[model samples]
Target: MIGRLNHVAIAVGDIAKASAVYRDTLGAEVSAPVAQTEHGVTTVFITLPNTKIELLEPLGADSPIAKFLERNADGGIHHVCYEVDDILAARDKLIADGARVLGGGEPKIGAHGKPVLFLHPKDFCGTLVELEQA
Candidate 1:
């Protein structure tokens, strides 16, 4: 079952610039940037009590995050992640209910040290869905 709503992921052209804006300008305390090689991106986390905000930047041209930026043509909100208690079961149930998963598999390590999976936007009324295990 789903737990609390986690961080909202945002795509950015430059992670450092985004971090400065979020931390210095917006007065949010940011965590040291973390690189998620498997996901093909780097990210910085802005911690909050209930949730966090993640700033994502593609690590290379082949990265899916890079394609995301190109497709949108503007760095902005990428997806909303909801924390779950059991990722495998969640994925199974979603699949059984006819939800289309992006990778159609188990949750993998993503930004902020959590196991994450992306559900196709087509399955959620054009809103990209993220399932995360904390």
Candidate 2:
């Protein structure tokens, strides 16, 4: 089952510019960009009181974020991540309930360096849902 909200991810053409908007204009605490090669994204996290906002820039032409940006030129909300105490169990339950899991239903190391899984958007109110191990 899902736990608390982990972070909301935003797809951006440029992570630097997005970080500045949060850091300079919004006066938020943003972290330095860190490349997640496996995930094919460069991330910048804006820490908040209850959760975090993740800014994602495509790492390469083949990156998924690149495709997302192609469809959404100006970029927008990418996905929402929720923490889970037992990711594997949650995956199994979601599967049994006929929910589709992305990436062949396997857990991948996320931006937070935690095991994570992405569920199909259609199954969750047209919003991509990411489950992260707590």
Candidate 3:
């Protein structure tokens, strides 16, 4: 089952600009950009009082964010991540309930260095959902 809201990810054409807006304009504490080659994204985390905002930029031509940007030129909310006590169990239960898991249906190391899995957008009311181990 899902736990607390982990983070809301926004796909951005320019991560530096977006991070600056959060850091300078909003006075948020933004972390340095980190390249996640496995996930094919370069991410910057804007820490908040309660949660965090993730800025995602495509790392390569084959990155999923590139495809998302192609569909949405301006970029937008890419996904919402929720914490889970047990990813495998949650995944199994969701699958039994007819929810589709993305990728190879296995947990991968996320930006936080935690195990994470992405559910198909179609299965979650047109919004991509990421489940991260808590």
Q: Which one is best on TM-score?
A: 2
- lDDT to native, each model: 0.84, 0.93, 0.92
lDDT of 1 by residue, 10-115 (tens): 9998889999999899999898888777778888988877788988899865787777788766698999989888888888999899888887586777655678
Model 1 regions more than 4 Å off: none
**Model 2: colliding residue pairs:** none
Candidate 3 achieves a global lDDT of 0.92
Model 1 accuracy (lDDT, Cα): 0.84
- Looking at model 1, residue 95 earns an lDDT score of 89
Q: Estimated TM-score per prediction?
A: 0.88, 0.96, 0.94
Which residue pairs does candidate 1 place in steric collision? none
lDDT of 2 by residue, 28-83 (tens): 99999998888789999999999999999999667888888999999999999999
Off by over 4 Å in 2: none
lDDT of 3 at 58: 94
What is the alpha-carbon RMSD of candidate 2 to the true structure? 0.9
Candidate order by lDDT, highest to lowest?
2, 3, 1
Model 2 clash count equals 0
Task: Please list the residue runs of candidate 3 whose C-alpha ends up more than 4 Å from where it truly belongs after superposition.
Answer: none
